[model samples]
Target chain A: MPYEKTLEELAARRAAALAMGSPKRLAERREAGILNARERLALLFDPGSFEEAGLLAQSVRPEMAGRTPADGVVSGFGRIDGRLAGANAADFTTYGSSSAETHGKKQGFVRAACEKNGLPLVYLNECAGGRIPDIMGAAGIGRAGEGGRYTRRRSSPVLAAVLGLTYGGGAFACINADLVVMRKGSVLAVSSQMTTSVAIGEEADPQDLGGWRLHSETTGFVDAVVDTDAEAIAWIKRALSYLPDHANAATPVQADHADGDAAALLDLVPETRAKTYDIRKAIAAIADAGSVLAIKDRFAKAAVTAFARIKGRAVGIVATNPMFKGGALDPDACDKIASFIVLCDSFNLPLVFLADTPGFLVGLESERRRLPGKIMNFMAALELASVPKIALVLRKSFGQAYLNMGAGRSDTTAAWAGAEISFMDPAVAVNIVYAVKREDDPARFEDLAKEVAKGTSAYDLAAPFMAHAVIDPRETRDYLARHLDIFSRRLTGAIGDHRLADWPPAF
Target chain B: MKRTTIASEITGKVWKIEAAAGSKLAEDDPIVILESMKMEIPVSAPIDCTVVEILVAEGDTVAEGQAVAVIEG
Candidate 1:
């Protein structure tokens, strides 16, 4: 596209494109190598197909009257890849994107646009929390909804960027989102680290306060962390690639498995006891390549809570790796699993559990962390999960861990087994009940312990109807394909309620 | 220029070192492995720096938040 127009024509076109207070800010953003709000909208939406709403709305306060800044937030409807999407921007530089009826109109408009049009909402938030003195006191408190969250029913995925200090209402937008990306050195916190540190009487490092480490590694809060705003935009594309414009749309892609026999999936797990292998390897081998996005990798080393593609179809993979501290659920691990299950269920993704846990981790730390509470929540999540779920005990399905993995009755359970389902490891069971001897009387104790541990093996549990079937380990992939095929999604999508969207980001 | 050292986040014995002394390293290269609660926790590099020295070896118990080695940040 060559520009040969006259200077006056070019200026006219530029003036029209700049909207209200966008030109000066756009120039500043261009100098900083940052995309302006309108530029971001161009990057997100389909070219030549953006129709904005309230492009000229502004503040209504007497002190700030005549400010046609669109209340510092822009709301519009556009088609992205032929799918309708709503876009909104909070003008960080303008009145702190404050809630004084200026941005309120656009914020509510964005929420309404998403709900009414069945489109994902995209928010580019870089605000100084909510407005201070203005949004305070009785008069300020009166316009409170503008200061907080007004969710759009989770009808469509909401993606947000915390390019700067994502605090107060800005941070809430990211937290409440289905996917959030934080730029390096930027933060996503309830309040700035200074506020947190001052309250706690400790020095604050952004990375230590609302830092990337706190969310990504410690709390498992943000979905992704990138070094730049550009990468954040790219991640938004990737996240949207998995989801539809709305729940009403059938999955865009079908399973890659085609007509079955995606090779015997059972051989993925090794038969050896001591040799530890990565459970992710099995997931990748069985599922489509590059489709698995693991969540909370560092928090729960035992359980692998990941979103993967089985046959190109989206599914949540919850598998326990015995290699990681013998794949025993700890309090942290339980919280991770429960939250993931609820999330996947809400998103209408099928759940695939690769069980190989010896049960919840025991000892002082587990007890102190309130392991029982974590386990109860996990049970509740599983009970409430309405998505298609299939659990496979790859090995070591000892004790309560098996039940937590969704075995036992079929009220909402689809417990199938690989060759290695057990009540408990013979050594542990003996130590607990009969007790393993440490030399001298070791032979007697080991024999006694072995008898008790025999209950840990798969057959013992199977006879009691704990595990529905004990299929060979190598037959796992095939069995999973068959089970996921039969599971239904009729009920989950009909209601379209993801209550956990507003739930706390972490345990 | 000053050097900073990243340490094992938890109390444990050093299990292994994934980086060699004097080797050029990235920001998060693991210097040693700490064994705590029967689990292996990785002690990562503080910043982009050369591994100037190896202060602790495998099998050495280290406390939580304890610096295991120094690196030019």
Candidate 2:
């Protein structure tokens, strides 16, 4: 009872900070079925595990001091799936959870702490952008940019979720995150519609400006689109399960799960080169059942980038989806796969490249998109990746795409008996090398095409040791599982060199 | 009834028309098989619907994002 009055004052301050915002605003959020910042943090971390940081902090501006709770941001460290991680959730109930000087410092503290501790960082972003007037001019804007918020070294995995209208800083975090799960109704953009309309003198719908669909389908920014906040958090947790807490840490491993029927791969992938099939089916057959988590799934339809477990160990799978563009590696697909390689390599997850590409896409439009440079970037990332890589040629691996898909670059390379490794498609080669059209001289073209295809078979590549082994289609899963185990044994502690750790998260 | 225009996802010549006009189709049912990059790429119905029109015939070239069929759900 000696310091009762001081204790009372302390409790009063804590209560005020904990209250978050006016009751009416909190009630409005509840009515709208949107979780508040604190609630989101609760859902993100384990039960009673979150240790709040800067809980007593408020706005630095005198006028905004009493109104802002936790300075419009809640940041702390907690166990996500029993691994320590730092998280910052923007409190939309207060000032629309806008990024201001004080909150920016708090978020920076969490980020720095995560980096120092070598822990993953998560940003539950729903900010309204830089706080008006607070970050309007030179002094304020300079303070906002102080901690290198936009510069991501990727020392640790950074995950973000866009659960509501997210602009400027929020959008930047989402874009830079290694994994981003966006809620369906949320909008993520550099500026909100009001600012865009005023600046451009044209009205715009928020959804049209930066909807989940736009990011998922066009920009390739978001990894997954979910319907609810819980689903988004679930996705983040699931993705994090596949990654190490930090770049130097050993990749996480789980108990061996049932392997998908490898024999089904033979049925899923067509032996006939002209018959296109969904590569995902083959992927599912090759990976452990129910362990494939696709990244940028909706963006680059021609490429499939996913994290899957092969015999209980995490692996990154990059496959060509023949269903789109005849499994050609276009500029977008190249970027997608390259970014994925950077992620898997940085996190020490071994990579599995399922090659079935006809090569890079051609034509004026593809060139205009700078396909050559993108192809090189893809190859560079693949070459720079220090993680154990295993390549499996299911059908066709042609031209530079074969290298891009880890043919010679992988630690172990295998091809199905029917796999074709070629500088170009045999049919196309016949036209170019022999100057014979299929329609003009069907019989002669067939003979020449068959002649051109002679040295492109899996046996042809194997005879010279270009392919380490020629496998049966039914042995695809077993081949990868065994090779992954073999390659893993070479690693001192299942950790990679992480050569691509500093690669930009978004291309 | 909601009308939808099914678009070809790639530039290719129509190799085969699997669904005819007025044919009832289920989701993912291939309406036309396009030949591109020496592979048969199927342009399928996005939803369970009835084909109202076929915009391209077999061997006709179609550009990417080109509307190739009309359907009503």
Candidate 3:
């Protein structure tokens, strides 16, 4: 009892820090079905596993002393599903969780801890940007970027959840993360509507500016959108289940689950060549039961990129979706696939490309979106990935999309018995080559088209060894499982060089 | 009741008309099938509704984002 007075003061200060903002604001959040910063962290980590850091910290400003609890953020390290991880959640009740000198330091502490410990990092973002008056001067602005907030090296898996109105710093964190999930009504924008209206001289709705629909469908920044905060948290946990703890660690594996009937692929995919079906069904049939987690599922309907397990091991699947744009590779699809490739390669997950594309889309709109540059970026990421890659030509793999979808770029290239590999459709080729349209000269056009299509079959590609094997549609599941086991990194210990680890997460 | 205008998501020639103007359709029911890039793409119903109008006939070419049908739910 020698330090009785000191201990009493400590208790009082801790009590004040624990009481975030006020009772009124906390009750309002609860009524609105939103989770507080501490609640979010509690839900993310296992029970009784979180260890708090900077709990007694407050604002350095004399005028704001004792007003900002934990410097407007809650940060620390904990175990997520029994695996060590680090996190920081913005305390919106405290000064709107605005960025300040002390707030930035708290986030920096968690980031540094994750990097040092080689653990995954989760960011529960709900902020209102930089604090006014405090961060107005040049000196204050200089301290804002002190912690490398914009830098992402993929040293560890980074996931973000936008559970409320997130702006400026919070929005940047969401975009820079390897995977982002957002609540349906939340907004993630560079600036709030007030500032945007002042700068642009036009009022913009928050939903229109950076709502979940915009990010999910247009910007392609968010990987998934859920109806509630708990749902968003669940998505983050599910995504982490398929990734390694860090860049240098081996991917975790679980007991193998039974796969869906492989014969279903024969019916899921039409052999008639011109018929379209949902590629998701085929993906589900090939992967272990209930292991497919589609990424950016709403953004690029023309292509599908997902994380799945085969024989209990993690893998990345990039397949063409024939239901949209005739399964062509458009600008958005290219960006989505390239970003996903970078994530999987960083985590040492082997890749599988189920190619059934007509080719890259060509048009005035595609050109305006810089399709050429996007295609090159996709190819670069594909080439830079050091993990094992297998490209299975399921139907049509034409033009540059053939190479882009693995072909010579992958470690193993195979095709179904009815797959086609051609520069263009034979009917279109005949019209261009011989100047004979089907309507103009039906018999001549038919003969020329047949002749042109002679060397484009799956057998033709396998005969010259362009395709390593020609398989049956029913054998797809078994073929991928066995080949993945064979090409798995027995010598390298299943860790990749991570050449695309530093690639930008957003296009 | 809400009135909705369904649009074609891609540029293609209409290959088949699967629903009539007075038909009641469920969500995701194929209203029209289009041929583009040598593949059949369906323009499905966005919601459960009664088709009010079919804007184009089979064999007519439609641009992407063009309104193809009207429905009342």
Candidate 4:
């Protein structure tokens, strides 16, 4: 009676649009151990919560008609753990999900929607670079430039999961994300090996070009690596649990229901300073139980960076792993800590520093790797970060690493009873000053070391106002929890301008 | 046979050789130990192999990434 025929026609078109690329292509994707675009969205979002946008969008040009379904992407709003989130998943089954004018526009649309709604954006990137014919000539070039440009100004978090052979625009989305999770076998690169080889006249395998190991260990682009898409999605959900929904919003507090004895930390650190112990044990004892999520753990062995909660409040932790290089900061460690700091600062997360370092790594290899440049860069990041930082000298905080770890940069700083805060190790300092090694003059070296050690003890520094307090090891949990409660207010509103909110992740 | 070099990750003195030359080892077995920053760090074989050679003697200084031993699988 009232345009019923028209309504039926619209319904028929929608059904056809949702069918995606083809049954054969979809089956091939499944056989390859990859999830279909729709399935990926289903896994990422809460059940029945997704409200798709641009579902009926097809190719704008007549030549590309009937080929691009949803313009090669599936974008929508959904809830992740009941918190609103946005996603744009590339439909690898459709024209290899390569970016054309429409694809880029759709991506831009979803990104803008996420920004406007203050929802976290997740990109399920799996594509074969840019579409060839659709992106040729004047009009096409203008549209390409107009879309898929990442400015990094969003207040809400942007995360990416590289699930397949992601290149070109896919690579951009993954690399530019605030944090990225990559599937174990997937590769993310600026261009295909074939294209790169043709352009540069050098050939290499795809895995060697942009494999998970390279991104995770060398470029530091990937924050986590998992064996499956489901695992990656689960990780993304868990990561979001630590962040506020948006910049103006307060950080979410869930009943993580921390259940562990804080006093366990008293014995976590070894009584003898020379012995190596797992810093994770000390961290677990002090942080909210079961809330620690370590990032890049295998890459930078010396610098241990993780996200954990203290009394249901989120905080970024940068600690030294005495088990590796005696907690010395190397080139990899510097990059790791610097990126972690930027991430924490971007999301308005407070920083907690647990420092015990001999010094920056030194030698021919270190110099060859530009250790000084990396250290200076890390120091610059530490100094520029305006987040509320709480520092604790667990045992040995020596040399330039002492200041770089926020001993002097933090809002609240403390030291353990046995912690030593000095320019260098007492023995090393004596040798440098007196031009004598332990083998040369043991007695004089011992005397000079003792004299220098007297001035560098935690008590001496606390007495002279160099440190705020010299507390018992067991008091660490209570002190940090209380400080976090006081500083939690800094995570909301304009208190923190989020100076690093738009910082690029490539560095 | 594949030969893998075990390198020291820190600039330090060779504290000890955990496995003698020609000894058999499984994956992740410590071949040599280096002492730096008053900490003992073991340079371990990445895979099951037999110790082919020990390059540095105990008390000898080795730079970071310096080859400390070689293992053959």
Model 2 vs truth, CA RMSD: 1.4
Worst 10 residues of 3 chain B by lDDT: B35-44
Query: Which residue ranges in model 1 land beyond 4 Å of their true spot?
Result: A1-28, A62-68, A146-148, A151-153, A193-203, A244-270, A322-326, A409-419, A437-442, A461-465, A489-507, B1-73
> What's the residue-level lDDT of B15 in candidate 2?
93
Best by DockQ: 2
| Candidate 3 C-alpha error for residue B13, in Å | 2.0
Q: Against the true structure, whose lDDT is highest?
A: 3
Supply the DockQ value of model 2: 0.75
List model 4 lDDT by residue over A25-122, tens digit each. Answer: 99987897878899999999999999999888888778767767787899888999898888999898888899887788788888988888888999
What is the lDDT, from 0 to 100, of the residue A422 in candidate 2?
91
Q: What are the per-residue Cα lDDT tens digits for candidate 2 across A1-507?
A: 899999999999999998997889899989988888888889999999999999899888899889998988999999997989999998888898898988888999999998888999999999899898899888987888687787778789999999999998888888888899999999999999999989989799899999988999998999999999888889999999998889878887787587778988767887897788889888888888999999999998999999999888889999999988889878999999999998898888899999898888887778889999999999899999889999888888899889889998899899999888899999989989999989899999999998998888899999989899999899888888888888875546877777887787678
Q: Write the per-residue lDDT of candidate 1 for residues A179-203, one digit (tens) a residue.
A: 6777677777777766777798878
Candidate 2 lDDT at A306 equals 96
lDDT of 3 by residue, A61-81 (tens): 988987888988999989999
> How much RMSD separates candidate 1 from the native structure?
5.5
Tens-place lDDT per residue, model 2, B31-67, is: 9999887778899999999999999999899987899
Q: The CA-based lDDT of model 3 is what? A: 0.90
Model 4 lDDT tens row, B1-73: 9988888878899888899889999987788888787676777888989999999998999987789888899
